[model samples]
Structures are given as C-alpha cells and as structure tokens.
Target: MNIFADFEDRVRKAVEAILKARETALPDLSRVAVEPPRDASHGDLATNAAMVLAKPLGVKPRELATEIAARLARDPDVATPEVAGPGFINLRLEPGFWTGHLAAILKAGGDYGRGRRTGHKVNVEYVSANPTGPMHVGHCRGAVVGDTIANIMAFAGDTVTREYYINDAGEQVNVLARSAFLRYREALGETIGEIPAGLYPGEYLTPVGEALKAEFSDRLLAMDEAEWLPHVRDRAIDAMMAMIRDDLKLLGIEHEEFFSERTLHADEGGKIAEAIEDLRGKGYIYQGTLPPPKGQAPEDWEDREQTLLRSTEVGDDQDRPLVKSDGRYTYFAADVAYFREKFERGFEEMVYILGADHGGYVKRLEAVAKAVSGGAAQIDVVLCQLVKLFRDGEPVRMSKRSGDFVTLAEVVEEVGRDPVRFMMLFRKSDAPLDFDFQKVTEQSKDNPVFYVQYAHARSAAIFRQAAEVGVRLPDFPTLDASVLAGLSDEGELALIRKLAEFPRLVKAAAEAKEPHRLAFYLYDLASAFHSQYNRGKDFPALRFVNSENGMITQARLALVRAVAVVLETGLGLIGADAPEEMR
Candidate 1:
C-alpha cells in the first residue's frame, strides 16, 4: 500500500469534515497533498492542505492548520499531528505503523509496489535506429530509457507495447545495399578497391556480403544495378536488423513489435494517401508556400507552392510540407501515416523515445496526433541526450567495428549488461551524461550499480548467517506481530521509512516518464539499508541476527527479506539484475 497516498486521502477527508461541521462550502481539494517531510526530523509525513486551502476558505493559514491538526490527531495510526511554519502540518506515525507496514511488505513480496492494472494501451517506440548498421552507443541511452519506461509503465498498470520502427525504406538502405554489393564482389574474388566515401565503410557488412555470396554466388555479379539493388537491399536490411536485435538482446531489450516503414509506402502509397485524405477531409491539408528561413537563408531555400499539412492550426510551429519538389511524399507524410496507423490500432498514448537531435520533431508529431486522431489520442516525445564515453578519465572516441562511434555491444562486452543499463539511467535522459568505464566497473560504494546490488547481496548474506547461527527465520505467513515489538531501534525504523516510499516512488516515476528517478530512489534505499547494517556493526544490539535473542532476530530477518524483495523488484523494472552474491 502507498502510505503517502493513503495519508493524502485522509488529510483531504479531514479538511472536508471540518468544512462540513462548519456548514461551509468545501473548497477544491485537488491541490492538497501529503508527502514525507523534506527533513526526516520534522516528521513522517507533511501536508499543505492548510496553506493551499486557507485563502479559498477565508481562514488564516496557522488557524486552519491547527484545526486540521486536531482532526488528524484522531487517526489511530497518527501519533502526533503538529503545525509548523506558516501552515504546514507534520505527522508522526505510531511505531507500530512502520512494523505493520514491514509485515505487509513481506506479505506482498515482489508485488509490494506494483500498481493495479489499468489496461490503457500505450505504444512506446524507441531505438528505432535505421536498419542500416549495428546499434551504436549514440542509440544506447534512448534504448535503455525506452525499455525501462515500458517496464515501469507495465508495472504501474498500463498496457505497454514495446516497439521498434525500422526505417528500411529510406535512401540509407540503398547505400547499405551498395556497400554490401562491394563486399559481395570482394567475396567473389573480384579485386574491389577501397569503399567509396558515401557508402558505409564498416567491416560489419562483410558478413552480409558473404551471406549474399552463399545465396546467389557469382550470379548476382552479372545483373544490372537496377535488377540487383532491391535484392541486395532487402538482404542487407535483414542482416543489419539481425545484428541490431542481437545488440539489443545484450542489454536485455526486446521489442514486442518491429514496425517496418516500408509498409506505409506499399500498395502504391495507399497508406500515406489515405492519411492525407483523412486529414484533408478534416480541413488539415492544403496547398501553401512556406516562409523563408528565419536567419540567413540556406542554399536550398525555395518559395514554390507545395502540398502541405496545416500543422500550425493545431500546435506545430509551421504548416509542414506533405510532398517534396520531386513529387514523392515527404518524410513528414510518412510520420502522419505512422501515427494514424497507431491510432487505428487502438493506442490511447504513443510515446516516442528519440535521440536529442530529434528535438525539433516534437511539435510536428504532436500536431499529427491532434490532426489525425481528431484529438482522440496524444503523443509524448522523450529526448535522450548524448552519452560521452570515458575510459579512466580519457575520452573514448572510436570503435573498431563501427568505425566512427562505439557500438552498444562493445560497451556491454567491456563492462557488462548490468553496469551499462544502470549507468545509462543514472542521469536524467535530457541531460548530457559522461559514462566512465572504470568508475562503473569499480567494486566500491562510489559505483551506484555495485552499491545497490551489494545491498541485495548483503541481505542474502544476513539470512545465511542466521542459518549458520542455528536461528531459523520464521516464515512471514506464520510470523506473529509480537515478534516485531523489539524492532524499535532508530536505525531499523529509518530503513522501514525508506521502504515505505517505494509504492509512491514507482507511481511518481512512471507518471513523470522519468526512469532515472527510480535509479536515484534505489540508490537512496540502498544507502538507508547499508547505513543500518553499518550501525549494527558498531552496536551489537542493532544487529540483524541476534542469536541470543530470538524475538528481535526474527523481526530483523523479516526486515532484511523485505529489503531484498524490494531491491529485486526495482532492479527488474530497470532491466538490471539483483545478484545474490557480489562476486
């Protein structure tokens, strides 16, 4: 159960009761909130009901706070409700409340913080890197962020669909085909020279070339460019996509759907035409001339009239072009069709996890959702900033396989999947992050991944130590409440307080679409657990396994087990592992 949410409801009800007794109209309660006080010393929970509602109710802040405090003091779980500052109310819960919550945690185990299913369909599209090459470090952050978002959203009760959009119909695929054709010729013992400057130069395509050689042998060598281009392009896209999938699997990511962009252009551009017609019927499509560039005009500036989508009528900065000067549908047209397809599939929300470079596409995408869905659906774009790799303080620039950038597989191979996934989410997705290879792999508290996983391992070690001491921890199902009476130590209570925040934390992080918050919260929880363990070392009475005292020992073991359960659940949400042993 979310104690904060529970208390928030109680606080609101308390105010409503106060209003009812006075025969006054109840003010809006939406602004009222109950949360853990910023300073633990203040109290267990704090609320701003008095401060936010006093003016609307025509009452003084402190006067209203005193009234609310008196009403809240009636709760059996609230030990004391004190009014502090101007109008804030701080609540100190009874010690039994924490221990009882710890029992609830054990009862719930891994499902302690999981939300009730809402069944709202959500499509999260991430790591849609063109199926042209292996995934590079440039795409790693968005991949992890997107995957974690889907995981947390599912845990928070939404129906999540992990998706990858393959840009296989683009000019880049044609370039890839030519690159593979060069390698194919080389594979056939033809004296091919160095790759052209415009073609992909990575040797990763060498395998694709060899595959084509095995499938068609020298027969492809005699075909015209027009005849063989499509054959090579399709094969090359498949090979690149296979490699990309393997790379994603290295990070524990697997999309439920892999959407091909080519399908939108199929049936003689039927889908794109349909989307345009739909928008046109709704008065969103028209022929127009775009204004010139704001600053010094670029070399390609043209003022000719073209088919356009009146995106500005919705929310975009400008009306967008639907067709290029060459009469082919523009990329924006494909985006419209793609969004329409998703809406038709019954997705209420579409989340796009894109690289920082795609920040300009946000408004246009939002306009598309509004126009095509007729305001029935919405789109949210999350941009992941660049990740700069460092090896022991020196910048790492090149990869042997990727040529210009580090491959995601190379990063995972060097450090490991857990470290890469956890560290990628260590910073806010929109902020630039510097990932130090050495620091992340270090086996110390300074490394967040190690620090958090060590907490789980330490809990396991506690149970084992208890067993060695001939103290069999009682099963949660049969444990008695009296067994937890001796768990009144400040350190023990503090850890429970931290554990109590998990459900609230999960809901907040999921709603904000910020998985980094989970990473930070897990670190804080680990710190609280580690601190309590260290306290036991200094004072024998605070130890988790007190063989001489069976009562307190059972209580502490229950706490340790709860910590391990929460750690495993949080780690799973972030696509990381909670190891039972650190080594």
Candidate 2:
C-alpha cells in the first residue's frame, strides 16, 4: 500500500549492504528519501540516498549511485534501477508488485490508506466564532478547514479532539445581551424605538427576547442594567450558540467540546491567575512598560506599567501584556489560561485555525505554548485566507435574509452542503478561494467533487452491469493478483500506480497538516478513472466486464471496488458525500 515506504526501506537496506561490502563508516541516514520521480518517464520511484551518503563516505555521487542501483536491482519488487543525472537512483517496480497493491487495498477496505496509531493527543481549535450572532459565510472556510484537518489527523493515527472556544466573557456578549433586551421589551408589547448605535442590531435576537419574556414576563424590565445583564447574557449566549451549532450541522460539522472563555475567570483557583503564576515562577513574567511599536509616533501611544509576559524570549516580536491598564485580564491572558487547561488535560499537540486577521497572534501563541510546556509540546497555527463568493463571475454582495453578508446557512441552502464543503477545501487553507456558485453546482467533470463522486458511482454502475451480463465477479479478497497479468495496457498500469500512491499521499498530507492535498489527489484519481473508462469506448476489449473472459473481468472488478472504497473514504474525511448516483 505504502509503496514509497516499502521502497525507502529497500533503499536503506541497499545502502547498508554497500557499507558492509566496503566495510566503511557512514553518517546519519534518516534524511535519505525514496520518492516518486519528478517525471514519470524516469521510473516509478527515485531516491537521493546515494547522493546524501556519498560525501560522508568520501565517494563521488555517481559512483555511490551506481553501487546503490546495482544492489537495488536485486530486489524482487524492483524490476529495474538506473542511475540518473546528479546521482539520482530511479526504479521501476515489477508489474506484479503494483497488482498486489490492489489486493492490499481490497483487504483493508475503507481503511486502506490510513496510517498506524501514533498515540498522540492533539487538540484542534477551529471556528471559534463569537456566540453573538449567526455564523456568516466568512466563518465557513475556517470551519471546513479545521474539521478536515481533525478528520485527517484522526485517520492518520493521532487522537484528535475537535474544539470550539466561545467568546462569552468578552464585551460583544454584553452587546448581545443589550440587543436581546430590546427585543424582550418588544415581545412584552412594549414599543422599543430604533436600536441604539454600538449594539447588535441583527434580527436573530428576536427569538432570544421572546424566550426571556416567556420566562419572567416583565420582571427583567424593572431591574438595573448590572442586575439584569447576567440573566440576559446567559440566555443570549445560549441561543446564539444553539443557532451556530445548527448552522454547523448543516455542513456536517460538530465539535467535541465548546470551551467557554468564562471558565478561565473562575474565582476559586482561577485559571488565568494560576497560568500567570506558573509562568511567573518560571521567570517569564514581569511588570513593565513596553516601547511603542515601530512606525508609530510616541504621541500616538499611551505608555503605562502593566503585567507582561516575556514572549520576546520565546520568539515573539515583543513582550505581551497579560493585563490591561483598566485592571482587566487581556485577551492574550485568557488564551494562555485556555492553553494551559488543554495541556493539563493531556493534549501534547495544539492546532489553531484562525482567520487572516489573526496572523499577528501566531508567534505569541507559539511562545505561550513553549513557555507553558517547557518546549515539550508543539503548536501549529493555520491562518485561513478570505473567501469571495461569486455568481457568474461577479461577486455576491449581500444576503437577502441577513441583509449584510451571506450567512453560512444561506450558502449551504443555495448549493447544498456537499458543494459548500468540497469547494472550500478544493484549495489550500491559506490561499484565498473564489467560490463560484454556478461552477460548484454543475453536474459535469469541471466540478472536482462531482468528478470524484462520479468515479465511485460509475464503479457501482459497472458492477451492476457486470451482474446483468452474467459475469459474476468474485469477492474482492478472492481475486488473485495473478489474474491482473492480463492487464498490461499502459493506461491500466498508470491507474494502478495512482491507486498505490494513496497510502503515501495520506501520510504526506497528514504530516503536513494539509488536507487539501487529499482533495487534489482524489481529483487526479478521478481523472485517471474517467480517462480509463473513456478508453474502453474506443477499445471494446478494455472494458471492465468482459463477459466471455470472467477472470480478467473479476480482476478489473476488484480494482474498481478498491477505487470506490478509497473515493468513499476520502469524500467522507472532507465531509462530502460519495453518492451512488448523481442527481
């Protein structure tokens, strides 16, 4: 399945054999990589092991490449090995080797490309949208990206926890409370005037107001702002979170935990104070005045002494204040506490999915991770770029219902969740995506999701035809690899090679924390499948179900079934549907 890994081992053994033959010392070999050739014409695989080891052994790269190639040709799986330019060793595997890969895939079923267990606890925080309003389209990209990353990490063996951080303790929630109170008065037959400025004016708060009115009739109207704010704030936050969760469900996303920012401010052994104390004892905390940031006039800044974290020592651009001049904990302070909570709960790896606006926060967050974990834990931040929704090449300016920007729910309703999620992941997370409504909903091959899903559906249709034609294909496991000997067509071989690359592709994408690679891989695989299917139209003998020759048909059927399994598994990871038939 992981042919690259298998060949890498073979290359390593060949190097060891050469070292033993010469009885010479060698340097580290961990960096030696056996990968696919840049040009497929070179070979099935290429390795730079000889070039990497040559200098340490005091030999020319070409000489070392020759020695490695000679030893590699002895491998039963390796049909040919040659030394190419710059000491690259290119290898082509035996046809039976790729054929056996089909068997491996069939045996594993949906789990064919997944990696072995790594036993690492990873916390992935994404789409922590403020619980003050319905989720808009702006939140869609980060939500899909984070969810896909968590899914890929789990498939690639890490224990993943999907999390959302609620901004409940912020001033925005107070504004939400005020917005709801106005709606509450309206619910009780009070004619409240136009919503005041600097407060939430969205009509989504009307229901929250109705709910408050139902609970206490008019008692809340008699209380002071301070007395009534907490009651309204909790209810509004709960209502907003419920709405957000429903919106996320439309896209098939559900976080395992929704961590509240309020939890960090608990008076009994407060986490914020505790986190600060932990850092203070470690000598990374100080009280000081910071210099004005670059390019800013001194008059434009207000200098004051405050509690600060020595984030500069851990690679941050400057020291960060943990408390504000107003005697309230800063946002960074809450972030540190939340991070410490996750760390104490046994997460060794932390991944943050943020928007482009939060790019400046990466280094400081990484610094906090280092300070809290003493460099034992790792932090990775993925800053998702903007997404511009377009319709027929023109940008969509507003949403009819929200009257501001398009809500994520509205987008899902327009084109369906499959298109929304797939198109969002069709590109890398950090790249700005142009989501065209007309293109994604198209039923043609131009749509990547449709093309990939059609591949699975086409495989199913082929099996149905196979049954109708009186050619009973054997179970996938019973299809002997030897039967594939009849499949000598270059197209068939190339398709098989692509299928064999799935395991390696999954590993590479997961290690890089980039799930978009899988999307691209599925599209490429679908193109190959579609191309091979089209070839059968010109050459009838290349058809998958040859009624007169059941053995070969059975072998091809096995390959088809494996492709369906992989396509279904891949679509599921990215939260897209792999339909049995296109609608």
Candidate 3:
C-alpha cells in the first residue's frame, strides 16, 4: 500500500525502459527517489530521476525527462505526467488510483504499514538499570524508547531481541546488599536510624530487608562479612529486578533477555577473560599510561600502567581501560564481553538506548562492538535526554518514597500507563521533554495522546452511529471500488493523501531508528482527521453520515475505518493502547 514506493518502482522501470530503447547502459538508480511534492497544488508525486540519470546517460535532464514523462503518462494509474522545473517529473494520479490504495489498506488491515523481511537480527539493549532499586522516572524514557525501537524494528521485519543488561556485578549492588542488610537488622528489632551516607536511602528496600529476615532469620547475622555479603547481594538484586520488572510492566515494556553482567565473570571459561584474551591476540590489548583526563591538572592525577584496549583505532575518542590497577575488569571490559556474546549469537546490529549521562560510553561501546566482532558488528547508541514532570505549569513534587527522583510506579499510578507511554514518545528521545500532568490528561486537542486516541474513538463511534440508524456497512469484498472514487471533496482527498503516507512513514521511521517520528506522524494524521470532521460542521454534505445518500456515507465510513486502522497500528508499535472509547 506504499503509493510512494509504487511510484518509485514505476519511475525506475520507465527510465530503464527508455535506456534499453536508446541502447544506453543503466547506471545505479538507488538515488532516484519519488516523493510527494512540497505544495499539494504542484502534483500528487514528484521524482528527480531524470536529473540523477542524465549525466550517466549522456543527455540533458529535460531530454530524458520528456521521454520518461511520456512513458509514465501511458500508465493506467497515472492520470497525467508533466515535466516541471528543470526536469522534475510531477505526476497527478487519477482519483481511482487513490481508491485502489484505500482498498489495499482494507485488505492489509493491521499489516498495512509493515515492511518486508530484512533478514537482520538486531539486539536492542536498553534500561540497563542497576539492580539497586525500582526504576525511577529517569529510567522511563530509555525503557520506552528501547522497547518502541524493538517493536518498530520488528514491524520492519528485523528479528529484534529486547535486552536489559543488569548491573549486578558492580559496587552499586554491594551498596544495595548493605542497605538491605540494615533493613534486615531493623526487621529483627534493631532500630537502624536514618540511612548513612553513600548508601541507598529509599524506603522501598524496607520490604526487601523484611523478606530477608523472613527467609533466613538470625542465620545470616552469625556469618562473617565475606560469607554473608554474596547471599544478601544476590537476594537483594533478585528482589530489585522483580520490582523493576513490575514497574516496566506498568508501561507495557518487557525485555526478551535480562542479561547479567555477573555472568561475564561466571560463565564457563570466563567470558570476560576470553574477551580480553581475544583482544590481546589481536594486539589491541596493551599496558599503557593514559594522559590525565581533561579538566584535571597533571599534578592532581595519578599515572598508572593499566590493561587498555586500543579503542582509538576503532573510532573512540581515546584508548579505554579494560582492567583497573586492582585487577578487576572495568565496566567497559564487561560491556565488551556482553557485546561479543550477542555477536556470537548471530546479531550484528546492536542498538543501545542510554541516558544522556552515559553519552561518553557511546563511542567506547561502539568501538568494542567493532573490535569484538572484527568489524562484523556495529552498535548504535541513542541518548535520551532528561524528562521534567509538570503539573499544569509547575514541577511535580518528588516522591517521598524514592527520596530524590520520582518513581516510575508513582507516575504510572498517577497518570495511568497510556499517557506515560504516549507522552514519553511525544518528543524525540534526544530532546528534553516536559510532560505536563494536567495537559496530557486534558481531553482537548492540546494533548497529542488524547487527540490520537479520540480520532480512533471517533472512527468507532461513526460505525456505531451508522449502525444505530439502520445503515450497515457493505461487505468490503462486495463493495464497488467506484463508491470510494466518488470522494472528490478537498477534505476527503486530503485525508486519503495522509492515509496514503502511512507505509512510507513507517519505513522511514524504522530506517532512521527514530520511533518518535511515528508518534509525530500519528499526531499529524489525527490532526487531518479532526480537521475533516470539523469541516463537516460547516458543510453538511462533507459529513460522514448522510441518510439521503447511503453510498456516499458508506464511502466516507470506509475512509474513517482506514484512519482507525493506521492509528491503531502506530499506537501498538509504540506500546500504547488505541482505545475504542476515551473516558
């Protein structure tokens, strides 16, 4: 149902046919693209094919344009092919052509905008939240972005693996273990006062402490630090991960794999050790002294010999340390092993959705992917900026339970899940977002999620109203395609044109790795639908329901249904519900 794609194919064939007729060798035609003209008055579609192929064919663009235009004018679907502006081909499609595109939409239904199989296995790792506590508002953006990307890539026919890398092997989890132990002691009648500095102070872990007390009682109290730490740490991480999963569930996000950083050290044959050895074999591993990091005086920094990876050779800003002076693998080293594991499992395309704070980790991890896979795999990192929550115009109060940041559970419970998911995606991931509590909840057109949802609900309401008035929809297969062709009103044509852009929009968003583009497209489509609906208020004949003429009403209902189909598909891709009724 991609009208633009169909036109591009036709244009390519037309040019190739002309080349064959003239006995000229065809050059690469990949850059020859057909897109909608900027001004609707210009035409339905435009192509730069003549300009791109002219030099290769040894002719002026206008000469080739005349030949291509003549060939395309003969197409049954194309009403007129005119040469416009220095060899650009402007095509005006017959009204019947749009009806056929609409029929394609009905035939495909929810599968309307999906792409053909690309045969690429993609690993999308996001929300690698430390298994320290429940996910906070800060983690929500990356979670939604990553999950939406996985969904979009899958829609584009890529085998997508949604992954979460649990940071359970780090010092943060050790702090979590100690924090849980305090709660454990508190459960056993020891009054542990205000949480000490350098430890997690949230009250959420009080339950984790109570659970530990219920499971082991005083048995763990008798063990030495080294003996009890691992047990408590493992239990704490498991509980935190469970809490995090529950929070993610509230937003409809579920990862296919919860990869453990601890596994890199524990996996048979030591994956971290093997990864380092593999790099060393390639001469990428070396003992080196790094220049003191920027902004620090040389006297203030300690120069130490360390195991470093030749990350600069693979496009990193500088060589990165693989192992610290104390012999523990740096965080980057474990990331390398994890990437290698994914690459070995047959995924060459890796996408990481990280927060803005982790911007520095981008190039190093990309370098790791290239080095570990021997240039066979590459990583794309999307950095999500901060989200500021507002109630009307003022900032929302911080959660007392979360101590500093608001918890994802609180936001979901306060606003419900749909707003949280949709509003999070309402803006690009790299831009800072201000999510207003009152505005998103408002039923007016100011709220994008509400507007899109209402467009869907209105489409359903049209059917219900039509059925109430004893007007049943004609069977799609039995209906005359000419019924839809009668829709020649400016508003009707505008909506159909927007609907025709869905497949192209989906492919563009998926290829650009920007799920927010889909969200914006849905908003635009909703705006067009709303505008058309409003137009009927002033011009009664433009209304979707007409008792005097059931044929015209049925055709308009067909258009409404198509709008719902595309809206539902787009919302589903971004993990939001397309409600039949908005309460």
Candidate 4:
C-alpha cells in the first residue's frame, strides 16, 4: 500500500472535520497532492494542503497547518503531524505503520514497484535510423528510452507496439546504392580505385559488394548505370538492413516492426495521397506561402503559393510546407502519412523518439497529428540530446565522414550492455550526456552501474550467509508476509518506505515519459541499500544475517530480498541487467 496515499486519506478526513465544524469554508480539494519531502529531515511526507487552502478560507498557513495537524493526530497510522516553516505539514508515520511497511515490501516482490496499467493503446516508434548503416552510439539513447517506454507502457497496462520506420525509398538509399555498386564492382574482381568522396567508406560494405558479385556477376558487368542501378540499390539496401539488425542485437534492442517508407507510396497509390485526401475533407490543407525559416533563408527561396497545413491553428510556431519547390513531397509530408497510418491502425496515442536535432520538429508534428486526427490521437515526440564521449577526461573524436564515430556495438562490447543502458539514462533525455569510456569500465563504487549491481549481489550474499547460519532459507525463496510484522530498525523501516514507493514512482515516471526518473530512483535505492549493508559491519545486531536470532534473520532476509526485487524490476524496465554478482 502507498503510505503517501494513506496519509492523503487522513488529510482529507481532517479537512472534512474542519468543514463540518464550520471553522473553514469548503476549499477546492483538487490542489491536494502529497509528496515526499526532498530532504528526509523535513519529515516522512510533506504537503502544502494547509497553505493551499489557507488564503481562500481566510486563515494563516501555519495556523491552518496546526489545525489540520490537530485533527489528523486522531489517525491511528500517523504518530503525529506538525506545522513546519510556513505551513508544510510534516507527517510522522507511527512506529507500527513504519514497521508494517516491511510486510508490504515482502508482499509486493517484483510486482511491488510496477505501476497500475491505464489500458490505453499506444504506439511507441523509435530508432527509425536508416537501414543503410550500422547502429552507432548516436542511436543508443533514443533506442533505450523508446524500449523502456514500451516496457513501461506495458507495465502501465497500455496496449503498446514498438515500431521502427524504415527509410527505404529515400535519396539516402540511392546514395547507399551507388556506394554499394563500387563494392559490387570490387566483388566482381574489378580493381577499383579509392571509393568516391560522396560515398560510404566503411569496410563493412565489403559483404554487400560480395553478395552482388555472387548474384549477378556477369550480367551487371555488361550493363551500364541505368540497367544495373535499381537492382544494385534494392540488393544493397537488404544487405545493409541485415547489418543494422545484427548491430542492434548487440545492444539487446529490437523492434516489433520495420515499416518501409516505400510501402507508403507503392502499389495502392500512396498513403500521402490518402492522408491528404482525409485532410482536404477536413479543410486543413490550403495553397499558401510558408514563411521562410528564421536566421537564414535558402538563397533559392521563392515566395510562391503552395499547399500547406494550417499548423499555427493548433500550436506550431509557423505553418510548414508539405511539398518542396521541385514539386516533390517533403519529409514532413511523409511523416504526416506515417502518423496518419498510426491512427488508422487504431492507436489511442503514439510516441516518437527522435534525436535532439529534431527538437524543432516536436511542435509541428504534434500539431499535425492533432489536426489530422480531429483531436482524437495524441502524439508525444521526445528529443534526446547528444552524447559526448570522453576517455580519461579527454573528448573522444567523432567523425561522420570516415565512420570513425563510436558504434553502439563498440560501446556495449567495451562496457557491458547493462552499464551502457544505465549510464545513458542517468540524466534527463533532453540534457546532454557525457559518456566516459574509462569511467564506465572502471570497477568502483563511484560507478553506479557497479554499485547498484553490488547491492543486489550483497543481498544474495546475505541469503547465503543466513543459510550457512543453520537458518532454513526457503529454496524457492518464498517469504510469509505476516512474519515480517515486527521489523522496527531504522534501516529496515527506511528501506520499507522506499520499497513501498516503487509503484507510485513507476506511475509518476511513466506518466511523465521520463525514463531517467527510473535511473535516478535506482541510484537512491541503491544508496540506501549500500548504507544499510555497511551499517551491518559496525552493528552486529543490525546485520541482515543474524545467526543468534532465526526469526529476525528470516524477516531481515525477506526485506533484503524485497530490495533486490525492486532493483531488478527497475533495471529490467530500462533494459539493464541486474547482475547476481559484479566482477
């Protein structure tokens, strides 16, 4: 049970008493939201309920807090409630209530920390990187966030599908084709010179070239660019996509779909046409001149009327063009069709995980989705900022030209997938991240990945030690929740409080679309675990494995297992492995 929720019920009762006594007028209770104080010394739970209602009811905040506290003291669960610093109600949970939290922890286990599911259907689209190249560090952050979001959505009871949009029929693919053709020539036993400046220069393309040689070695030699280009392009794309899939597997990230952009325009006319037709029926599309982007407009800019969506009618900064001057659909046009397809597929909501460079696109995309769906579908587009690499405190060089930038595979190989995933999410998504190759690989407590993993390991170690003490630790590890009713140590109570907040924390972070929140929470919980473990070294009685008392050992071990479950569940949500032991 959520202690914060229980206290909220108490506060509501106190307010009802105040209203019944005619001491205060009915205040709007909508503003009532209880939260744990940032500083633990500020008390177990803090609320601004008195301050929120005081002015409306014509009373001072501290006075109102004192009144609320006096009435709330009647609650059996609360030892005392006091007014502190201008109206904050510092709730002190009763000893029995705090001690009983151990039972809650034992009862919850892995399911303890999971949030309630909303049953809302959503589509989480991410890592839509081009299939023309290997998965690199640039794609890592968004992929992790998106994958975690899908898992989080599942935990929250929403029907979720992980999707990857493949840019198969784009200008970039044409370039990839030409680059692969050079490899194809080399594969066909031709002594080709240095690869062209505009083409891909990676040795990874060697296989794509070899495949072409195997497939159409003789026929392509006789044909010129016109006949061979299309065949070469299609074959090369399929090869590159295979490489991308392999690279993603290294990081344990997978997608439920690999939707082709070509399918949007092939066979049955085009999805762009369908989307535009739907928009036209709703009167959103119109022939109008778009304002040139701020700062610097293109030199070739011409102020000619063109079909545009009235994006400003929603919340976009300016109206955007759906078509370029060359009478071709823009990428924005394609995105509109993609989003429309998502809604047509029956998603109640959708999330787009994009790189930070796409931050400016959030508003326009959200606006269009709302406009197109007639306010039915909601899309949240999150932009992940850049990750700057460091090695021994120096910046690692990154080059887009030579493919010298770090790949996600390289990072996962250098440091395991758990560290990479956890470190990538250690900060807010929009915030820039500094990933140090040296720091992550280091085996030290400063490394949160190792520290957190060590806590889990220590918990397991405690179970082992207890088992050696002649205590009958269950083989399958089932604890009776009722037996944990007498746990009263500060460390045990603090851990219980932290463990009991998992479900609430999960729901908050999931609702906020802030996966970093999970990372932060894990760090705090790990710190708590570490502190408690270290305390056992100083105070023998406080140790998890108490050989002198079998019942105490069982109950304490139960609490330790509860901590491990929460840690495992949280790490699992973010695609990080909870090591049974850390090397």
C-alpha local distance difference test of each model: 0.92, 0.88, 0.87, 0.81
lDDT by residue for model 1 over 237-298, one digit each (tens)?
99999999999999999999999999999997899999999999999888878898798864
Q: Candidate 2 residues 1-583, lDDT tens each?
A: 6888988888888898889888877578898998879899998999999889888889999999999999988889889999999899999998888888878888889888888898999999999999988999889999999999999999988999999999998888998899899999999998987778777777888999899999989999899999999999999999999999999999999999999988898784289999999999999999888888778543213388888999999989888888767677877899999999999999999999999999988999999999999998889999999999898888988542333778899899999998888888899988899999999988898998888989989999999999898887787866677886777777888888888888888888877888899999999999999898899999998888888788788888887887888899999999998888877
How does model 1 fare in lDDT?
Answer: 0.92
Per-model TM-score on C-alpha atoms: 0.97, 0.97, 0.95, 0.94
Clashes of each: 0, 0, 0, 2
TM-score of 1: 0.97
What's the CA error at residue 349 for candidate 1, in Å?
1.0
lDDT of 2: 0.88
Segments in model 1 whose C-alpha atoms lie over 4 Å from true places:
296-301, 399-402
* Clash list (residue pairs), candidate 4: 117-156, 117-157
Across residues 173-199, which tens digit of lDDT does each residue of candidate 3 receive? 898899899989999999999988888
Best by lDDT: 1
Please identify which of the two predictions, 2 or 4, would achieve the higher TM-score against the true structure.
2
- After superposition, candidate 4 runs with Cα above 4 Å error: 20-28, 55-59, 267-269, 298-302, 474-482
Between prediction 2 and prediction 4, the one with superior lDDT is 2
